[model samples]
Target: MKTKLWFLLGTLALLLTGCQSKNNSGSAQQLNLMQTSDLLSLDTSQHADLPTWNTLENSMEGLYRADKHNQPQAAMATKVVQPTNQGKTYTFSLRKNAKWSNGEPVVAQDFVTAWRRSVSSKAQSGYNYIFSGIQNADAISKGQKAPRKLGVKALDKHTLQVQLEHPMPYFNKMMVMPAFFPQNRTALKKFKSHYGTQSKYLYYNGPFKVTKWTGDNDSWVLMRNKYYYDKKQIHLNKIKYLVVKDANTAHELFSQNKLDDATITGVTAKELQGSKNLIHEKKAGNYYLRVNVRNNQPLANAKMRQAINLAIDRQALTKNILADGSLPASTYTAKDLSIDPTTKKDFAQETTPQQTYNVKQARTLWDEGRQEANLPKKLTLKVLGDDQTITKNVAEFLQDELQHNLPGVKVQIRNVPDKTASSETRSGQFNLSQTLWLADFADPISFMGILNSDNPQNYGKYHDDQFDQLYQKAILDSSNNQQAYWQTLRQMQARLNESMPVIPLYQMVESHLVNPKLQGVLRHPVGEDDYTRAYLK
Candidate 1:
């Protein structure tokens, strides 16, 4: 009887210990989510992919973040500022209460430092070109000027001033982009080359702080930032993410209640149908093809490029292969992204179809291209793409379509991890590569700017003097003459239609199984998913 009494006491003690540990971990206030790809990098300037940027959006605070209405809202900044100097300058007042994870106060100098570092020639930031209109930014990126002269200054500890080369109509909206996030110079100096490679090497000031990341881990956790300015408003105390590439695995995990949100597409999405837990989110992004025209003579031929573009049946790829509510793309920009101020027409509606499925025309163009270029009767080309289920499916479909429609062409599909595929394509090491671009802001130029001759992201190396001139006019006239700006963009789209440098496949719609109990998650059309205000109901 005495031994039984002791055993019961020990069991009660064990239960109490477990409860204490659970409370310490804040399990009740935690969220579990999934990402389709691994986290590549945490460095805002270096990362070009969506997953990394999305993670940054939650852990790092910028001057602005998108609200539920997809409008710019104050984050690190106390309020959004109106531009001066004829819309060429902006001065922001930062929140004095803001503090970084390392216990240092977040000041205006942080923005100045980060802006300079991003635009520096040595950074090789893929998104730095987004700062094209900033005074001296282009010169600094080209190594012609010092980073100190790159148009940003710390007017005071709490005030930041930015000068622009021209009036950027979207400058306010673009503040929410990851490229504009502040960096702690102390952390950078301490970690040096290893900064932002792991959770411990960096600091955070947003709603959450990354933990348990070891640079190459497939999983990570974000704990609530104790130092955040608006900490009381943040609901989820911890957010966890795991890389689940396969849709079936994600679905199974979601069904088992191991995940609060699961990203599923293709067959799984179609099967889910009308489930109350399922959420369909149409992204302001599009998947497209980049041809290595700079290195390949055959692909450089406009007829060859046009033939390749016309051969793919985008409708089948979207409806049959993707089957996730994705729309077949015709314009570079996704539909409903922007409506013309005067005409009130969607950007995609205003532009003509760049390329359409036409097996007959594709075959004719293929033969004529070969004849014009004095090429062989039979030709082979390799395509590089990510190994993700959806992307791989698309790549395989492209291979079959190109081979079957072009008659004399043999296609090879090479699948690699997203990171390797991105690097290889950027370096011009592939004949053709599959890529996707999401808008940095709400503007159509965010998509059209990729084809600019000066854009580093222009992997295809497409160049036309007239196209370049039209693009510049669009930017310069953006705030001055809206009608001229709109017309120039239309003209640019027509140029792409004729040149066929890049191929537009479809606009992506992300399908997910989110827990019905979770509430207040804001999925923005032009920015990362906002979870700061999310909580379990």
Candidate 2:
């Protein structure tokens, strides 16, 4: 799933409208915030990081945005419509009042243009996979069909129609994703290749507009969009963000009142234990180690991968290193994403052989795998991770645990910026890539599809014919048989546990020191927080 921007929920509208008049006073409504990383791209079709999506969600309006309770709510669309043709066909009537920052009316063709570009063969859009169930999308993505043949069209100026290959139960929830947002053809044609790389090249339709962003700058600002249809409900005049990767630095900025909101973890999170301003948000994402199993790497051996998985102490890492209420992960999927239709059981909580911490067993397996792969007794491997303080701490902890458990193995920790880590991992430049996935929507497929043998996001290059076959079966059953689909998912996860392509680490819990005065800031379970309804009291 492509990373999405954190958008304003519908439920906050009333509260925001009530406080709108009071916030008009100069400088009082501005909210100072901090991000662990800088924005990568403004283009929704290209960005795969959280910060970039967060910025886009604030700056662009989609067909439907989430309500405060995480329910589907209409944004650009006048109302959320029911799917026709057995849940395959959808017709949306967009709000006529909506206009782009450039004063161009947001028509249905904008969506068509963006959707077609995403599935075009030449684009190589990492997110085009999400359009799989849409008619002709798969063919277009594979270059078998033209982009214009994909099953989406603009009926008229304000009407958009979409045809799906199958009945997608979670399709409505996907409308809020950044990839589903419309693109201005005028801007695309005007800026050409430079489009979405900088803030100036894009047009805004959401509550906020990107006023200052140099694309590579660590500091940026979002100002209220005057052209937004619901501009009257917007309370915050400005949202400023500064990249502060160090937890200590974030806490210091928050303490000095330089930042109204700061994400703090590790020692800083532990220190703010009982503070009134502390907000603990358990995110619906998992952090795992992506093992490079391609080209006969040491991790290509299943036994070697299992040995590595068994050697890590997840409990200590989450409690001691993270100290942010994150749960140790036993599987690839995070908790609460889905429930079995028959048993009503949570997908992540379903019983399966667990990932255990057994140093003795790990050591024995390591030796066996080494001999089988014709490797030396002493081996060295490098682990790539983000340079953020919390991530760096986790990387260092993994190094210690692996080296300590496997006597002859030597581990090296390489810390780089988040963008660099993502780039390197995508290019298969590391033995082990410390990465994470924030689901685009709350479905098992969103997480499971990443490890698909042909998935672009499968940075580790792990492949298994059996796993891919089983995963395809699950996809086939998704629209027809819920029970069989759920069972297939369980089986796929079991297969993952056996292969150990990715080491399940922990389910993240974002701990933030948000100013008490900054009311109405909505923190979502799946993605980043929204500041559209926020106000400095």
lDDT of each: 0.85, 0.85
Q: In model 2, where do residues sit more than 4 Å from their true spots?
A: 1-28
lDDT of 2 by residue, 167-246 (tens): 88888988988888999989999999888888898988888889778889898889877788986567788889899999
| Total clashing pairs in model 1 | 0
Tell me which residue pairs clash in candidate 2. Answer: 5-53
Error of 1 at 409 (Å): 1.2
Best by lDDT: 1
TM-score of model 1 vs. true structure: 0.94
